[model samples]
Target: MGWFLGLGIAGLVVLALSLVFDGVLEGVGGGLDGLLSLPVIAGFVSALGFTGALATGAAGAGAVLATLAGIAAGTLAGWATWSFSRALLRDGAPAPRGEDLTGTSGAVVTAIPAGGYGEVLLHLAGQPVKYAAKAAAPVARGAEVWVESVLSPTSVTVRPVER
Candidate 1:
């Protein structure tokens, strides 16, 4: 009973440290996170080992068997948790809407030759977004332009601003 409580406390401390730091100590590598994270493995294994030992009336020799069982159980649990969390938190970015660009003013990043593609930089959602641009006539670099239409998701048509 005493061993169980001690191990449980130690496991809780390890989990707390892992959460509080949140990989700031990942200089050595990120083995402290993901499915094989040390804190998670330790917490699961220690809790299970304590429970198993108590349930089976495990004594000195039986302690080793209980520990081995705990390790196997912990590994599976950790893997399952990691996989589930990753699926839920998968990388995804919102699509930039086309209507958001039309009529917006931007500056030419590259000189636009007559009927040719150049680049323009516009501020969208407080971030700079660069898109391919075109003009009916030549537009010099750093010249202000107005977005005429969205040519594609990543490109746009623009015209030089008069004076």
Candidate 2:
């Protein structure tokens, strides 16, 4: 019982150290492909020690039986920790690009002369942004326009909206 408690305490100390020095041991396995991350090891050790103590103290199990139970619990804890960490590290949606502005609608901020450039207030990624605009025909300030194509990183070709 005394040894089991000591092991449990040691496991907790290792877990604390892992949190404080995160990524330090990430390359320890060299070729394991992140299977031996600090969090996974910490979870395994902590679960093993605590479960062993519980099995022995609460269930009155012998040392061998308690150890077996602890190993099973530790493996499960390690696998779950690995899965959760991988899920969090996975890539998310790609960022919005200037090309995505084509076909979107906006309002002309500066009156556009035919065959010239003006400014339009457009929404890119749901946020208002101003961009240089060109049209085949003159457009008045505050008139709604539809983007026809993106000409550059900061410019677009547009047509006045009918409605």
Candidate 3:
């Protein structure tokens, strides 16, 4: 009982350390990728120690039975931790790019003189952003426009919307 309790406390300490040194132990398993990450190891140890103590103290189980129960619990905990971490680290859709802004609609924020630059308000990745804009024909401030082409990182060629 005493040893089990001590192990449980030690496991908790390791878990705290894992939080502070996240990703540091990711390479410890060499060829295992992230399967043996700190969080997974910590989950296994904590579950094993705590479950062993519970089994022995509450159920009056012998050492062998307690240890087996602890192993089963620990395996489940470790697998759960691994799965969750992998899901979080998985990549999602590629980020929106400036080229993606082409053909998108916007409004003139400042009047654009023919063949000169002004400002337009457009949505990039669902967020409103201002860009330096140029057009073949003058566009008045607050006029609706369509982005014709992205000229640079911070500028675009636009055309006034007829309607």
Best TM-score goes to which candidate?
A: 3
Please write out the lDDT profile of model 2 over residues 27-108, one tens digit for every residue. Answer: 7879775678777887787788888899999999999998898889989998998899888888686799999999999999
TM-score of each: 0.44, 0.60, 0.73
TM-score of 2: 0.60
lDDT of 3 at 14: 80
- Of candidates 2 and 1, the better by TM-score: 2
Please give the CA lDDT of all the candidate structures.
0.73, 0.89, 0.90
Rank candidates, lDDT, best first: 3, 2, 1
Question: Ranking under TM-score, best-scoring first?
Answer: 3, 2, 1
RMSD (CA, Å), candidate 3 to true, equals 3.1
What tens-digit string does per-residue lDDT give for candidate 1 at 59-121?
Answer: 553666766665666566657656665677685767668668999999999999999999999
RMSD (CA, Å), candidate 2 to true, equals: 4.5
* Highest lDDT against the true fold, candidate: 3
Q: Of the pair 2 and 3, which is ahead by lDDT?
A: 3
Lowest lDDT sum, 10 consecutive residues, model 3, at 1-10
Candidate RMSDs in Å, in order, are: 8.6, 4.5, 3.1
